[model samples]
Target: MKFLDHPSRNLFFTGKGGVGKTSVACATAVKLADSGKKVLLVSTDPASNLDEVFDVSLENHPTPISAIPTLSAMNLDPEKSAAEYRERMVGPYRGLLPDAAIKSMEEQFSGSCTLEIAAFDEFSRLLGDPAVTAEFDHVIFDTAPTGHTLRLLTLPSAWDGFMSQNTTGTSCLGPLAGLQEQQKLYQQSVRALCDAATTTLVLVARTESSALREAARTSEELAELGVGNQHLVINGVFQAVDTTDPYAVALQQRGAAAIDEIPAGLNAFPQTTVPLCPGVILGIDSLRRLGTLDSAVATDVADESVSGDDELAPLSGLIDDLVAPGHGVILAMGKGGVGKTTVAAAVAVAIAQRGYDVHLSTTDPAAHLEAAMNDERLPNLSITRIDPAAETARYSEEVLSSAGANLDEQGKALLQEDLRSPCTEEIAVFRAFADAVAAGTNKFVVLDTAPTGHTVLLLVSALAYHREVTRQSSEMPEAVENLLPRLRDPDFTRVLIVTLAEATPVHEAAALQRDLRRAEIEPYAWVVNQVLSSLPLTDPLMKQRQKHEQQYLREVSQQQASRVAIIPWQLQPPTGIQGLSRLTHCDLSTSPS
Candidate 1:
């Protein structure tokens, strides 16, 4: 691969979820290790699947991959890291402080901001402190999806600016009272990332317009952050060998068109393309074969027919069940790149067409709800986004005008400084989410949430804030106070776990379901999107992929969800009212032309 030709000391793989970031990173690491270089692979994603990819158990510290002698890997498990971080921050003051004070400090550390900082602390230690990784020849980072990854990468500058400008001794970045001591380390990390000689950022994407568009946006954003040493890896570029199969031809043509219209921002970088594999990339052998032209198609085709297609229901069946609830909140959530926005929009349109008022909104930082709608409008349907920047600004203005109105200039300055902390966005977005949920009382509200990691954080924040609201009942908003109850209430909230019939997305969605069940929020259904099993295809590669998808589909229907919905792969991208309506109107037996 071009990205591996002259690898830098620090290599970061990042893009949309399910775009094969982990696969590409593992393959690159394996190739380098085979070349007699000592390598350490680290995953900073909250929902890291490095363990699954390597088929080895992982911890926060590096564990040697038994299959590869030269490679060691680790997962920066955010929950565990946050627990340790909280203990470290509060340990020194445990016996000295009163019980109430200690509890308050612990509560402060429970927010999502603390989890982010804790994870970054671990990341910074590896990148900033050279002596810590002196044994490894190369360090590869398999970062979280685009939105979360950007937030993690930009923290050094964000925190530096906040700390430098703040005259007050404290701010909302809770549990990091010793942030000043780590200032030098953060600065070093920043310098390392920006220095082209030390670090290379590989932007991974699939051969689809949406995936490529996201990659372009990420490329430009990182460039603006001074990390201009960028490379683009267009993964899953398909070429059909069977000219007669319509499905195969359509897939190839769509990919070619997406590449032909490649964004100008991504064109500036060195580019590499990895062909679509016939089967899921798992195990060390498969990882080694990745990105090689010879292994693009499977030689041994499975002649055994796939069964259990008749047991699965269509997307409209799920919509029908959801509509039975009448007016309530519907959340389409799962890993990124699994068509969550499209599913949510389709459900919203279906409901609005049923003569009910519907409001569709998104909390995902990188969501393109408008693009998904394709400028189509319904009289009963309204769409909005919980934009972090706008919400934070509005929140800050409200706080300053109400609480800072009577304060002196210095006090007001401190109040404004407190509001400028990065944690403020978390609070602002949470409130906006709660307000959006509150609207369900009058009409249907469908929310397209962020990718798995961010969605998990949002839920965790809800739990933490609920505790705070219970203790300080007088100051909390009515919407905030009622958020958890509404989420946990089965009749009020219906969550559809959206995923593709692929290894990583299916496993990640399963993990997400477990998380929700633990929080007493039951998923109403599971949506298996982009399945190819029902298509009539003669291409060996397409047939291999179809055979591979059956297991995951069976897994979802039989093991994961009580109710399951299947959406077949579409010939065209599903956008606009007409395209979206087809999702709700078509049956599983029908294939798109």
Candidate 2:
């Protein structure tokens, strides 16, 4: 593959969740190291499974991989970085500040965004500072999931805007007293990212429409920022292992169809395809085995079917619980790429098929729900999308008119500046989401909420208005006033924590469940989406993968709430109404467990 052609320096791998970016990136790094080049593999993902993959623990500092002489790896520890960032921010005032004051400062910087920015700060330091890369022939970065990555990559302008405003105030992000120099470095780092010679952007996609579409969107956005030296690696490309294998034939057919419809917009980029591997691409051995894929497609596919009453039982049970008479709201809230939209659509279809009036909506700014529907005809379910840009624009106008109309030019500039933060978009979208959730009182409402970190921040921000109300003694806006009350009523809302039968997704999902409980929103059930055990497989390679999947399956069954659902792997794409119907009634138990 072209992305692997360079065994040294400047490799960037990115993709949607579950598309094998980590595996592919690791394999490339391993290949380079085995070729006698010193390779440094780093993961900026908060839920990185690098330790599991290498079968060794890693800290922020690079640890030798042991499997290869020249390869080393590190996982950027967000919590530890956040702590260091806080210490640095408040260090100068150590003698002047009280212990309680310092504690408060640390608490203020303890939010999810602070952790994210701190991680980004470390990444920029490593990537932009040549000193860090001096000892390595190659630096491979396995980025966080898509949404978080997009935000991280765009931080240069975000920090620059904050610096230009120079607002002096007590804020939610603690004392911003030490930001000036950091902001300058941040801008420089962003420039470095966009410089094609210094950076290469790789978009990883599966042979699925949604993944491809997301890649196209990512390419366009990144290109606009001048990060145009890009390559497309289509992972999980399927080819029939045997002509007589009907299941494998069906998978190849479906995969080919999806690739045929690859968005014409992404045609400009250099592209490579990876062939399907019959087994899970975990551990250095498996990755190296994949690296010898000469004249091989970069695609790796899993279309296996598993047999067990347990596999099909979970989905049926979840359906029964959701089939009550009175209408209520169902929110599929969990980590990104955990199949929330898929589960939400399936549940909405399941309930609507039972004759309930259902309205399925998504607050994801990316608009994955519309594509999930696939122009399929639905009998009773109505799909609605809350556009973040639209909501933010309207909310910004309202806030400016009501609060900053009389301000001078400098003050107005600050007002516009504060409004530009992505946090403003979150607040605006949360209000719209609240309005949509409130609409569920008389009919069934299903929401595919923003991912875990974003959702938690949104809910926490809802409580901010209450704090603002008590401090100002002013009546709050109608939208802000109604949010907290509506969300807190468990009877009115049921949250489904969706996850994949995989280590990273399930671990992140568990954390999400805890966060939701902290916010007083208990998840109704855990839906383990896309399990190989639900699908039957005759291939030995696929059978080996099933064994690997067992560990994660066990984790999901043990970690989630008592109520759980499992959707089997489908050979065909889960697009349109008929496909969704299969997911609605996913009962795969004919094969051996």
Candidate 3:
């Protein structure tokens, strides 16, 4: 609420997944609109649920909503924009090329870089072009998860550097030589982003140490880029709503302590704290009310640790099914911000502590797996990351060389242009993923996946690309060739779907499950990370909110997965090795038979 005092026209909201970026952004936008300012709210996130939040469908262009006289909203579909950009880039050479060459070119454009570039292309037009801003009093951006947003912001420089070095030529990508007008726009966009006076960067985060540290890091990066006008919003700072509830008091104390550690650098900035709400933050009404944190829930903090002698409960039961001998892989899959990486890392730590040789790895673009394992002495656990930039670059170069080695200057130019599309990264990353997944046979392989949409696409593309590769050549690399079968083998892989108890994360996790089933990958367990109900409460309102979690918790238990595990809300935020290790309770393990 204090952020209103400064009143900047350009606002950005970014945080870890499920920290309520959308809710906060929406509420702020609504509040600004209520004050009679013309507002255009844009979501650059590929996984945006702005339509759901506002209870209306939104697309690439701005849509009028609320009849609020001056307020409008838009949900930018980066995929659609990327597809359009690809077509426009490749349209010129449609008929002159061989069908095989053309198909190869299209495949090259499908990389992750292409999508990023295309999204940036659209974003640049809106942010960099002064004409676009003439119609709005304020432009608010609800960004993707932190890692993706960082990549998105850093792309201009990445593309600029790449473009500066590469000469125009045809390689594996046929018919496309290089980027044309996009380079210029990207340069301008970079300038716009770095212009501190015009663009104000708002770092939205929870009271947790990791979130705060991320905010600090982002501040430093943006400042180095010359965008120093940064503000921090510490959201969901809670206090006990019930005086009598000891559990609520303890939980509130934990949250408060976390909030107390808000770095000194951010203290000087306009800081506003929203309270923990009692119910699901869905639809406009709920979103608008999120700014006014309701202290409606409280519950007694039950001792989260299970008795070592008592019959192993459902939580331990799920882990038992998973760590059972001969299950080649245990994959952690879920929407961003649901603690998949943490859960995956914890599982690896636990397994390795038990003497299982475990390969804990991640295909997440913003992988924190290495950080998660820092200083831990789990001799049996090792970590690997499928670095998208590295793998995608290698894949692109290989494809170009193999497919278009003999093309002439013009033909190669066209091929290069065709390959410039973003779909290419998806293919490349997926290939590396396939190779990595194949390693699960001899060890307990744990995979922390990308976000919901990207992960689903990754799985689907495996089958689809395998089919394509089979058509291309009989001598496909062993990694590409074996992708589908490895994924299809249930005995070789066990999927653990992770999610928060909230509506969006839970719904998204459920959707992810549906996608996995459609792809014939059965989930091994469902982990509801950071559950507060298991903790004690003292406030009446906090107790009410905890009570409300019963329905969703029940739903998660009954409908989300046949087997489930609950991690109690910790009194301290999870960060670094010490914090992450605290998650692995020895009592959570089943006794050896």
Which candidate comes out best when scored by lDDT?
A: 1
TM-score of candidate 1 on Cα atoms, chains taken together = 0.91
Q: Write the per-residue lDDT of candidate 1 for residues 330-412, one digit (tens) a residue.
A: 99988778999999999999999999999999986666789889988999999998999999898888778776787788677
lDDT of each: 0.80, 0.70, 0.65
TM-scores, all models, native as reference: 0.91, 0.86, 0.74
Tens digits of per-residue lDDT for model 2 on 50-143?
8988899998889998879899999987767877998898777777989877665655565455666777678778777778778998788897
**Residue-wise lDDT of candidate 3 within 56-107, one digit each (tens)?**
8898788887646677899887778878877877777789989886675676
Ranked by lDDT, top first? 1, 2, 3
Off by over 4 Å in 3: 144-179, 260-270, 282-313, 325-327, 335-337, 349-355, 361-439, 448-484, 508-522, 533-538, 550-563, 570-593
- Give the count of colliding residue pairs in each prediction: 0, 18, 58
What ranges in model 2 sit over 4 Å off?
A: 94-112, 144-175, 291-314, 334-338, 374-380, 457-489, 534-536, 589-593
List where candidate 1 sits over 4 angstroms from the true fold: 144-170, 364-367, 450-463, 466-475
> What is the alpha-carbon lDDT for the whole of candidate 1?
0.80
